[model samples]
Target: MESVSKIRLWILQEGRSIRSVARATGLSRNTIKKYLKDDNPPSYQRQAPPARHKLCDGFDTRLQELFEQDQKRPRRERRTAVRLYEQLVSEGYTGSYSPVQRFVRDLKRTDAGSGEAFIPLHFAAGDALQFDWSEERVVLGGVEQKVKVAHFRLCHSRKPFVVAYPGESQEMVLDAFVRALSFYGGVPRRVIIDNPKTMVTYVSRSKDRVFHPRFLALMNHYVMEPVACTPASGWEKGQVENQVQFLRGRLFVPMPAFDDLDGLNDWLRLPCEELANRAHPEYSARTIAEVFEDERAELRPLGRAFDGYVEKTVRVRSTCLVQYASNRYSVPSRFAGQHVSLRAYAGRIVLVSGQDVIAEHKRRFTRNVSYFEPWHYVPLLDRKPGALRNGAPFVDWQLPDGSLSSAMPR
Candidate 1:
């Protein structure tokens, strides 16, 4: 192109003769004349592709069909290139696996959704919040375990709050909201979440969700709308989804060690606060904390927490205890033969009968261990004086002063 441009400029613009242009440019007059006649620049032509082998005759079409079918199935159930190759071999295709593998790879790269672009999302202050759960490994009480960390991010301010729970149960989801809302000092107009069974019971064909009743109740109490993301759409809550990775690197890395979940949570709080001191991701001039203050003012004022609990009705056994989750918890001795509502919260279990709370015990996560309140058996002692000798609840009971000897059977 450079030579052609110079030649044309010398002849057409500068009025140089074709013979002089060819002589000066070290090209034959014939080549220079051809260059002048053709208006388009010279371009290289690619070699024609070699013909495909006989075995690939119907293989490309079959591969396309298999890939299209896999796209409709669940991601985990999708066939790999090797699996597709195996299926093709079973069907009597004599071609090597390389061609089949290449075709699948090419199809994936050119799929309709693969090459598409997404519009950048913008949020008004207090407009929405994104919630997600992440699994992080930490040392707690000398044991290395994975903790479920609930992450909450305000869409506008990008301020984040996280709390670790033993597991991601329905009650833990509620408790996380309580903690996050308290940290932000207000509630956003709507919350965006994934379609987890804990939050969403059903997602209709049109994306309408039948949110879990208790979860819906909490939203109703706060006058907030709950938004469920499409089944596999992590981009809907992309802020929190990204936060989970960012925070795992920033906070959980180096493996923080704490004696209890509370201590770990307390340690997590300082980092979260310090993060706000950094420059905001979008508005670099202002710190996240500064922007958070502005967004906080736009937020709805924080109200009383929802009394979130998973309630179950169970009949107390003969031993003055009720069972939940394969474990026994003592209710009041009087309710041993009666039915009571067991309200399970994130941290405690409360047994309620009618308007009365008969017994409350710290919730336990372990299995098969019975939790007992020694005082619940005091009334039974009067009728069964010999009970203290062999009762499981009294085994570790600490009697006051000399009361053990005085109360013993004489």
Candidate 2:
């Protein structure tokens, strides 16, 4: 690997004889003589550095700023990475996706560590139990309906509970949590969850999650901390996620049909409780119940029963009845034309006008024409008798003479 200049100087100054050059340079005699007349250098100088691309010129700072902004806002309007990418593109960023994706990936990795800042509980010592719902299908009265299965698994015991309900609304979600807490005989210090709109209203980029006010109020009532998982990492709540599939197969595979939600819920509870008490299939000495017993002491005792509150707003109609899920409910005549909040319980509907109980009725199971009492709808008939023509009270308004003109002007 001698320099070309050095080789040439050696050849010119030390006598260009091939044998003499080879002896002086320590190169093979034939090699030294061949290079003495050759004109070009070796061809190994073409290696170069990789190309540079900027997917996010200033996104790290922007992402940090966005996360800070989200802290003061509701979860429903938080900025997502996908949303941020669109924003970046609009700002005339000329970078390709790889860089953007890479930056986001790193950002999320850091956020994951920050988001998991939970006070770890000891195994078998009442560690935080998390509850959630995953979409499932079950047959109700011979019809297959889409539903969300309520799922709860003790972090320490890994003892899981599941119940299927018709929808993912707030009432159903909260109902499931109450039942799970009751079955466990206590509430964990913290209940972890994924961001369902029912519970979490927003997620901050700092990984702070904003819970719905009513939901947070429920947590406060139960004396348990509510921890929400990072939005995209479904794996953060993997125990319940795994139990969802397990329960789906073990409980719902045969697709048991039932008369109603109560019947189905009643039936689903037994086997799940049995499964929890039974010895672990793989672990000989431990049962789910055994592990959960240890977790119970770490949990906070239930405060006042949730009162099974299902908060909903309904406007009073002209008929003095509030429409709820395609069904009509009667309020007192005094509440007509005013907006009211309805608290639907298992057996009653409590209509509250700003902390004042305006009206309450036994909740009706049937969807069509459910009435609280004769008096509730009597005012409607009194105001407009014709309104009862297609109502449940239509026959009650008939005159003994079998004439429609009994009370009409003759």
Candidate 3:
């Protein structure tokens, strides 16, 4: 393509006729004449598409496989084009990503059939906080257990909090959130969470979000808005991404050690807080604490305390104990004959009698036995001494198997 200026120069300075300029430049004779008369130039292309790949082969098969994998896996777990290309190269593919990615993306369009393109978003300060969990195995005193850490992040400050917990239950999530709030000194105006059953009930009819009752209650108490991120977009809440790495590298490195979580948490609280206060190298001019203060002031104060947590209705087995989690909890002997609602929290359980709690016990964990007012098991102990020994591993029956003593049960 020739510029209008070049054509006009040829016509005026070089004395080329309009018809001749048109043949040379591939413009209409009239167009060439007009440009020469007006001295106006048309835009010319500066560049063309880059050269095509000569090395790439089997492009169709590769694209089909990539698209099939993307369809099979959740978006969060799907292999990115870069990763796919890397894997392909390892498997004797010499192709670069441009054509392969272009083809793979096109395949997505067909597979989607909805014409909706995946769009990137910009997050604003105080707008959203993303939540997720990561598991870390820590060996403390030769005992190794895989610990799940609840992670939270503030999008604006990029500040994050993480705490180790046993499971991803509602109670653990609530405790983690409260601690995170305290760590950040405020909550984001809106929290963007994944579809963890702890907070989300069912996917809404409109494919919106349905939050669990307890989760909804916490949101109401805090007066902050709740926003559930799309089902598979983990990057939606990426503030915790850096934090998860930071925590695992800094705190969990060389492996963490503690006799119990309570002791570990006590040691962990201060160091984590200090990490939050430390100045970020990227934004060395200000600390996360400084940025967080602004967000903290904007958050609404928490209202009424959360109604104590409890698991769903569980039955008392033939052994006359209500089973919560894997550990068996006992109510009073009188209530043993009847079913009861077992209210459980992070550290405690209460057996509710009507509106009142008839009995409460500090919740016991795995391989541990808990007994309430031991009189409840006297009849069973008398009936079967061997069963009593098996049932109460941590207790002493104070009687031989052949003889039933009238000793008071401790």
Candidate 4:
């Protein structure tokens, strides 16, 4: 091609004769003249050979069938590409593994879900808020544990609030809502969330949703509509999804260390405020915090905060302890063999008998631990002083002075 172009250029542009070009280029006069007569450069076209069947030519149907059949089997029991290749080889397949690998790759690409279409969502001031939970690993109290972070974002202002929890239980969800509402200083008209079991108990095929009874009460109290996204469809609330990713990368990537969940949440306050104060991506002139100030006027005035706790009734054992989350908490001996209402808060547990608060203890995350208030068993110990020598509840008892300890026998 280069030689042809050179010959054409020399004859047409340089005003050189074809014979002179042929003499200098060592080409036959006939070839040089042929190129010179035509203004276009010399071109070569190679015709493709006739197609022929290869050893793996008809394997597409077979692979599709095999994959469809394997779909009915458990995930761990399904066949891999290599295993399929071996089976094909045993069945008289004469092709190399490369073709099979390419076929499998193409099949997976074709079978993947189609690209999703996203609509640009617009929100009025304080119209809606998105809520979600994201998991992160962090060192708390010198121990590494996976923590669930609750994320809330106001759609219009892009204002965000985040808090860490020990788990994603119903109690944590409600507690997060209370904290977020308080932080935002008001409640949005609607709360958007995924179809978590704690909130949405069921969704019919027609998209009719049934929320948990307690969650319904919460919605009623807040005077906000509860909007649940379709099951497995997270993009319905895309704002909070993006916020979760932003927080994981910006805040939790280094795996922040704190002495407790409270400390971690307190540390998050400054970052969250900074995020709000940053310039809004869409509203170039105003920051999120400034925009939120306008949205605040649109929000509903929040009434007294809800007592966000999960309540259950448990029978007090003869040990004068009520079991909650596989751990025992001591109550007054008078409540023994009686049913008491156990209210579980994010940071503490409160036990109530009838209308009186009988006991309160710091919430424990670990299992098989017992919390005892020595005062709860004092009356029983006074009645049966002999049992005090080796009571399970008194195992770690210590007297303020050395005199009382010396009077008791070991």
Candidate 5:
């Protein structure tokens, strides 16, 4: 093709003789002359279809088997063409990778659910809620950091609620639901969730899933059924998936900052309500807030709040401490050297002994630190009178002022 173009360029545009172009391009002078004389550029025609190579001749059945097996695996864990090529090499394939790569690419086009078509879905009022998590960057306490933000959407009304957290974990997930349900003032009949391991422990060969026990307890407490979306199917909970992007732009586009997560959440709460004032997407005549008002009656009454927590049993060490996440919190001295129930929430940790909250504290994320509720060590004072003055737990404790003490009961 380059020789053909040069033949005309030298003879026509550069004013060079056809003989010079023929000599430079290794074409016959007659051929150069023929090209220059034609009004349209010469086009090459294949005399016959390219010959087929037998490298993949015996591999069709094997390739199909591999492709089908891959289809059954989770999308992320599925084998790519490169991996397939490697596997074929180990299977004694003597062919170049190109044929195998091309085969796999073509094989995927015929796969089930490979089409672009999708069904439009509908939900009844209060039928379901959707949940998702996304990470956002914002200035927190003068430091730029990434925070995992939980998003919730009412499927029918299109009402959205969002909360920010330091991290996304099992306890954080449970707490987010509590906060969202509280914000909406009721629970929908069902909740559609992505297949996050924090909530869905196991997704079987089919649609069946083993919901994490704590997450199941949360759903049962609110009388709501939990539904897990199939892997890679965001459309199953498109409402919250869309909200994750929508709120990321609306709320964090400018890169918000706050003194703490709570302040950031407080700021987000108002805008959530304000956003509801806009007209609903499906019902343009009614605002989302108006639609939600209609949805409220359909939602189940907000019952007693679920004690959203992740519980673990831990033995209190002789130091009157129970360790969690590499940090320890003091329990009552009497419970020392005994196994107690440790209930961890997003913002707090509580030590419970047969329904008694023996100790509670603001949860800390720093590792290897100990948090002490000074009063928890009060019972130990009877055993050692001198310990209080030298106790590490009481180092930060201080007596009340005279004016404050006068108000306390004797």
Candidate 6:
């Protein structure tokens, strides 16, 4: 095609002889003459070949039906391409798996929505915040344990707050939000979260979200509107999602070691502040800390903090211990066999009776580990001094240098 076009141009435009054009272009004089005489250049057109046979020629209808049937089934129950191929082979379809796979792929491409389009979102300072939770493994007190990490991020500044928890219960979720707001010194006008069971109780087909009673109460206390993302649409709260991954890699990696969850979280404070002090990705002119500072003024004032604890009334056992979860916490011996209010906090358990805090202990994660206060049993030990030798709770009891051992024989 190039030679023909060039020969025609040389002969007609440059007034060169056809024989000279053929010599210069390495083409026959007759070919050059034909190109010169023709108005359009000669070009080749590829002719479609006749339809050929396919190994899975007659299986399209069956395959399409199977795929359509799968659309009506649950995701876990849907058949994979390999499974469908095996089934077809069992049904005497004499084709390789590749054909069946390709057919399924093409069918999905045409039948399913090709792809999703997302619009970039923007938020004003203190306008919105996103929250999420992720699981991480860390060693605490020389024991490896799995922990849930709560992540919070301001949408405008990308500033983040992260804390570790023993569980993802509703109480923990509310506590995370309270701690995050307190750390930031203010609250955003709106809170965005995924449709987790902790926050969302129901999601209608119209996407109307019904939040949990306690979660709604928290929002009401903060005076912030709660916005839930569509189910399975994590991109709606993508900021916190990315923050979770970032913390998992940067802070959680190497498996942090600490004496307790409180110490780990306290250690995390400096790192979180350092992360905020770094240069912002979108606004390079200022650090995230600076941006957050600007946002703080726009945010709602830090009002009284919410009492984010789970409270329950439990009967004190004969051992002067209150049962919560699967563990027991000790109270004063006088309160034995009585009911007391147990408030489980993020780091401690408080026992209250008649408006008085009867006892407090560090919250325990392991089961059947009784937290005993030797002072709580002082009166009982005074009355039954001989029992101290074989008392299970007093097995590790010790006395001060000036004090006589009660377990010793009189």
Best by lDDT: 1
Taken over the whole model, the C-alpha lDDT of each candidate is 0.87, 0.71, 0.69, 0.85, 0.84, 0.83
Q: Per-residue lDDT tens digits of candidate 6, residues 1-410?
A: 77666666777788998777767778788877677678686777869965634546568788888789877864434567766777777778986777788788888888775778888789999999998988888899999998998988999988888888999987788899999999999989999988888899999989999999888989999999999987788989988887776576567655789998889999888788989888988899999999988998999988999888778899998988888878888998899889999998877899999899999998777887888887787678667887668876677777786464553334
List ranges where model 1 is wrong by over 4 Å. Answer: 1-116, 402-410
lDDT by residue for model 4 (1-410), tens: 78888787787889998778878999899988777677676666869965644435567678777777866865434566677777788877888887777777677678785767888889999899999998888899899998999999999999999999989999889899999999999989999999889999999999999999878878898999999987787888999998886677577655789998889999998898998888998999999999999999999999999888999999999999889898989998888999999999988999988899999999999898888987677678546787778888778887577644454435
Off by over 4 Å in 3: 1-126, 204-206, 280-283, 367-394, 397-410
Clashing residue pairs for model 1:
none
At residue 135, candidate 1 shows an lDDT of: 87
Candidate 5: clashing pairs of residues = none
Candidate 2 per-residue C-alpha lDDT over 1-410 given as tens digits, one digit per residue, 9 for 90 to 100 = 44666777777776577677667678787766566678465455748867756545576677567566754654333445555566677877666666666666676687666554434334455757878777655677788876667888888777777777667677767777777888788877788898888899988879788888878877888888898887777677777776776666466644668876778888878887688877764466989777667667777776667765777788898667887766778787667898999997644678899879977786664566756444555555555777667676455654467444443433
User: Model 5, 1-410: lDDT tens per residue?
Assistant: 67677667777788998767767878887877777777576777999988755446467678778878878864434566767777788888888888887777777775544667678889999999999998888898899988999999999999889998988888999899999999999889999998888999998897789998989999889999998888999988887887776676567755788999899999989988999999998999999999999999999998888888899999999999999988999987888889999999999998899889888989888889998877777767766668868999879777666732353234
**Count of clashes in candidate 5:** 0
Arrange candidates, best lDDT first: 1, 4, 5, 6, 2, 3
TM-score of 4: 0.70
Candidate 3 lowest-lDDT run of ten: 401-410
State every prediction's TM-score relative to the real structure.
Answer: 0.72, 0.61, 0.61, 0.70, 0.67, 0.67
Candidate closer to the true structure by TM-score (higher is better), 2 or 6: 6
Worst 10 residues of 5 by lDDT: 401-410
By TM-score, the best candidate is: 1
- Which lDDT tens digits does candidate 1 get at residues 1-410? 89888888898899999899878989999988888899679887879976654336688888899889989965434567777888899988988888887788888888854564667899999999999998888899999988899999999999989999999999999989989998999989999999899999998888788999999988998889998888887988899998887787567655789999999999899888998998998999999999999999999988888988999899999888888776789976878789899998999999999999989999888899998997787778877878878988889787789875564435
Worst 10 residues of 2 by lDDT: 115-124
Tell me the lDDT of candidate 4: 0.85
For candidate 3, report its TM-score: 0.61
